[model samples]
Target: MSYDDLMAMRPGVTFDARGEAQVLVWAPKAEKLQLQFGEEAKMLDMEPKDYGFWTLQTRALWPGDRYRFLLDGKGPYPDPATLYQPEGVHGPSEAFDLQEYEWSDRNWKNPSMKDYIIYELHTGTFTEEGTFAAVEAKLDHLVELGVNAIELMPVSQFAGDRNWGYDGVFPYSTQNSYGGPAMLQQLVDACHEKGIAVILDMVYNHLGPEGNTLGHFGHYFTDKYHTPWGDAINFDDAWSDAVRHYFVQNALMWFRDFHIDALRLDAVHAIKDFSPVHILQEIRQQVDALVRETGREHYLIVEMDLNDTRFVKPIEAGGYGMHAQWVDEFHHALRVSSGQERNGYYVDFDGVASLGKSFRDAYVFDGLYSDHRKRKFGIKADGIPGQQFIVFSQNHDHIGNRMLGERTSQLVSFEMQKLLAGTVFVSPFVPLLFMGEEWAEPNPFQYFVSHTEEELAEAVRKGRKSEFAAFHLEGEAPDPMAVSTFENSKLQWALIDQPPHGTMLQYYRQWIVLRKSQQLLRECDRNGLSVEVFGEKELLCIQRVWGRQHLVAFLNFSKSSQEVSLPFEHLSWHKLMASSDSAWNGPLEMPEQAEAGALTVAAESITVYANIINS
Candidate 1:
């Protein structure tokens, strides 16, 4: 069938023949569907579709048309596919001409995956204003923190102003609550200007329940596979070609249209497809082709539960060739050693052996049997360089999805926090810090959404409570609908003045300085990495060497004061880069001897000592 004929049967009005037009919606279910074009008002025909969709096509539709769909024929609803919502999430969706924005980052390209220090952040909680522009103010801080890129949480338009952004339904639209497309451009513009790159987290595995209107237009989802959220996206089922195209197009939009440096595909394990050419492989090939064509550094990162190195292996080498994946091994090992919390996956890693194994060999499980999973899980990453993995102490899911929305600080001592930070940032792997982690923001990053339908909102509130109940902390779960949920999640910028917060910030700055200044931490060769245990079950010593420079990372997991002798009998200690303590905390001091190689480290602390003598 011709494209025009196919468009006729679709529920909502899609693009015109020229692929250059604006769309209008007038759903009766919407209280109102009025169109506000920056300033002008165009009353929509709230015509109901036999398939339950309302749509309108206008020739005047061009890029930069700011408009909102009025629900109930009167209330304003952000466009499901709004390219830009200049106003925050509550405002109208604007028709954005992606071609108009001038990019000055010609030399900008994807940095080596193994050399990255990633910072994962949610737009809503990253700043008080919770807009793209607000984050622009913090670009320098991230750059100074030694992060190569900022991995933003999903930014696609979702149901409400305060969502985590994963439940987004409109894959093509920027979240209006976060200053939409134009604002996103400004953020990217500023990031490139500061020598920092942006990586967007995208969710294509499933769509949110409330605002997902794709069903009315096409079979975007199917029952062949089930995800925790709901029906899985139709990637191999009938009419799945269109569904696959939708996602592929969206992926290109972020890189080509929005000038995004990279995209972090969320939960690839949840995406089920039976096609001969896996959609992910197809995407990787396309992105690689784009890189060749444009000569811009572009990359596709995946968040895969499977420890298959195929994700990062080159496609020609019989692998997927994804640039990087988040390493849960790092998080599990460190959390097990530091927090001593043995719940869920943490059940497998409470032993010091796991921490040592993780430090020595990047993966704790490493193809071994997982008792909790009741199967042999995880593949060995010994040959893979650490930079291909994104390691972190805490992230949105680790904290926000928790029953109480507790951060790493809630579970571990302040000393351990420093140790954890050092472990991640100094390791050969790429590191990521969740928002507010730099200064330890007190706000909880919980699940929050704004739904226009009262019934949908109530249902969400109940589901959230039940979801957390499985952890046995349901009573402490914050109400999803409560205004306090959103309010409490806001970062209190004032915390920067506090003692631990201020100190931690300074500690991060020092760590970044050392990371940049030192050669050992920047080493990307897997063969150059090595580790040795100092104490059997209390402290661990890891040494990374590149060329002649050697960096010894000392980590003490125990609470009580304990000490251990260092390695390298032929060398002397040079200098201590950072410690968990400051002089103000209790006479914090560097190692006594300024010699080159061997030394002793304290308990509940992480120390970085260098060897000045050339090898």
Candidate 2:
């Protein structure tokens, strides 16, 4: 194959016009390479090419045939670009063809980032079967919840069956335990049929430790730079061109093959690349090329800890062309406001005032001094739009990383949960929800892993314990390796039929409906909203005005009722919905106020009103 042909798609199993399977691999370090295929384990010598690439073709290879490459005759390792691993990550790589699956979502156009209400869920905990088909069966619940986009946690092939999906060795292959690529394709088709876009979470900074043998092939890792996981990927070192191409092809494969609408790049801050053209920009350029070719909108969303707006800015503006990035400041501020224990990163946030700043500025720590960091952190995002930041009250890291793995419902009052949901939905930025948060699922989303090696499992446990020693919580954290820990994390789907759980679901549904119905909320313009904090009363007031629609939301974080005076008494503000209303199963107590035009906000509740006079 020519260089142009190699650049077109990821190098993997492909059938030629003669119906023979051909494979290409890059192994510059290897003096010799061989391939073993089929149940008979037939070995074939790979022809060395000029560009440090090895190629081989065989008529015996079938769709389900398993193969592995022998590098320098040391050992046979799984193909790095394998499409399907029918067995676990350590097992032989199975041959797969993208042409095998008949996709029905040809006309699917991705929803705009501004219009996305993303619901992030782990497939294992999302349903009882823990398969992609199982998730597809539950699509109706997401559609009814008003989420136009579903961000799935990483589904790549990891070490074991029960994992959070972060310890994935095969980036291109779907988790075999989750029904592999075929079931995933069916799920994407089902999601599109229900008008919900799919966003896949991809980890590119480092591959998992176990069952990963990329270093055996070439210099895929660099000792020049370091990451929390281990050695960083070689993006700017010698023999780095093929390494870059490998990951870029991974990104393109997800979009072009699976029809994934967007990719949520996991922990981009750790991607140490000093090249003139960043890996992110190259990804953006290629994705744009794909969009032009297919006439489908695709997005690249990143999760970075820095308060840098360059990722979301356009490429021509000397910034990475990322459609959006996760903004964790909103979550921290909201959690602190609701009386969460101030420790770790939460020490920097100062309750209601921080929450208010997130509403108006979208980036709370934009060049502001952080007490926790003991220095000024974050670049000022002066003119960034609200849609560029994705905010959520609860996500996998928020709940699962906790020592006790307690959800927001477990940490705060039921009314506070409602208030949190209202604050997220009413905000100008996009809102994301963790699985089972709508019905206040009592199950804790504890982090769980099922690595086959006992030594690695013990190391993970010790590391987790040492990390949480600073928090100084009461009891010991749950055992991440235990089956009970994984089982306990599953969402109780039947809880929505119960009393308080069902009522909380209704309250969440109302907020979602209101957010979609009101143009003021959907505008996602930073200039359209104003936020005020009444520190003494632990109250926040968010005022939004768009065209003839004027809306005001009063959020009370205190344990007692607080009355906030209306900003403009001249405008007749009619009550739209109060989370403390009886219909939502709140106490429904009407607090007595001495002054007129004072809005009584219930304890740990959110109250919104519309200006009827403006209309």
Candidate 3:
């Protein structure tokens, strides 16, 4: 199929072969469908097409016009493929021309997977203004931090202005509260202009509960599969072709229309599909075609909790052909080593030993018995490259899902916080930083929502409480319905200039600079990497060699200084950056040189050394 044909696959306000836009709706359940235009609700009959598609080719709708669908003279509802829901999810859908945006990113090129230093942030809370334009204004902060990509959490249209955005019922429409599709266009354009790529998180496993009208139009969901949120999307059941096309086109929309560099598929393990060609593979096939046509690189990153290598492996290797995936094992192991309370999944890890194994093997539980699950979990990810996994110390889910929503910086010691940041930079994977983590912002990222229905609101409150009942953490889980919960999640941008916060910011910036400048550290080289764990001392050493160059990191996970060996070919090893150094307000004054064999690293700190010749 041509690019235009692929764009037209989505049944709503899509451009034709001649490049003129038209309204098309797919309401398989509706006997008759009509178009309701403007505030006057002027009704116009829509001719039903062959397989439940409704179209009104005669009545042309322009950008900025408000409209909705009337199924069989029933009350009006928002379009399933609405481009902009200016009046919220329950209200009328406004038309916004997706193709009209004059992009300035023509000269921009997507960065390589290995070069991706991603910073994940929610659009609603990244800034106090809580809009896409506000996020663009913070580009200078991100540019200074040296992250090449920004991963915005799901931005689909949700119930109200305040949400983490996962509750969005409309998949195509950009959240109106966050400046709609137009502002999102501007953010993408501005990000590319600054040499930054955008990775949009898309939730396709299940739609949100509020304003969920897809069932009224078509069989978009099925009862066969169950997800944590609700019923799984209809990907393999009867009338699954239209459902598959709807989502595949949605993925294409992000890449083709919005110029998104990568899509982080949220929780692909929950997507139950018994079809020969899985939904994810089909999306990849169409995206590959689009890439050939546009001559630009696009990526699909999956968040599969299963730790299945088949998702990231190539299609030729009997996999889903995904570019990369968020590997939570690294994060879990790192967190456990950093002294996070052994609760929930943390109970399964053995601290530094797990972290050490994760460095060697991509998955810590690769075909091993998982005590948390009481069963064998995760197949071996032996052949996968490190760049195929995205690792983070703290992400939205990690922080927000906590009982009191405490950030890693708040829970761990100050020294451990810096140590965690350094470890991520030195890891053999694409590193990610959650918003406000660099500066140790003390604000909590509690779960919050603005659902209008009181019953739904009460259910959310109960659900949040039930999730962390096992953790046994000392504080009451914040009310999910409270506006304060959302307000508290916003990043305190001004904290970057404060004393310890400012110092932490410098530590992160310098670590990133070091990683980017060094040849061996720039990307993962499993062939030339070695990890050693000292269980008694809680010390982990990682050695990386590329050709003739050699670098080593000594990570002390203990609360006290630990003696470590630094074997070197030369008589002496040059001391590199260290969190224990006085530059970061630590006890140790880093020397120009270090003894080749033995050294004592500071408590909860990460120190690096290079051979005298390489240094």
TM-score, predicted candidate 3 vs. hidden true structure: 0.97
On a 0 to 100 scale, what is the lDDT of residue 439 in model 1?
A: 82
Q: 1-615, model 3: which lDDT tens digit per residue?
A: 343443366667755545565777778888988888876877778777666666666436667778888888886888999988888988898877787889888988999999999999999999999999999999999999999999999999999889888888989989988999989999999999998999999998989998999999999988888788777899999888778888998999999889999999998998999898889999999999999999989999999889788888898889989999998989999999998778988899999999998888879999999999999998888889888988999999999988888899789999999999989999888899999999999998988999999999999988887888778766678898899999989989888999899999999999889878887778677778999999998889999988767788999999999878778535577777899988898987666787777688899999998763544
Local accuracy of candidate 1 as per-residue lDDT tens digits, 92-146: 6667666666777766656766556678888887787888988998787787666
Each candidate's number of clashing pairs is: 33, 0, 0
Model 1 compared with the native: what TM-score? 0.86
Relative to the unseen true structure, what is the C-alpha lDDT of residue 509 in candidate 1, on a scale of 0 to 100? 76
Listed per candidate, the RMSD to the true structure in angstroms reads 5.2, 2.1, 2.1
Inter-residue clash pairs, candidate 2: none
C-alpha lDDT values of all predictions? 0.72, 0.87, 0.88
- Give the range where candidate 3 is weakest over 10 consecutive residues by summed lDDT: 1-10
Q: Which regions in candidate 2 have their CA more than 4 angstroms from the true location?
A: 1-5, 16-18, 589-596, 612-615
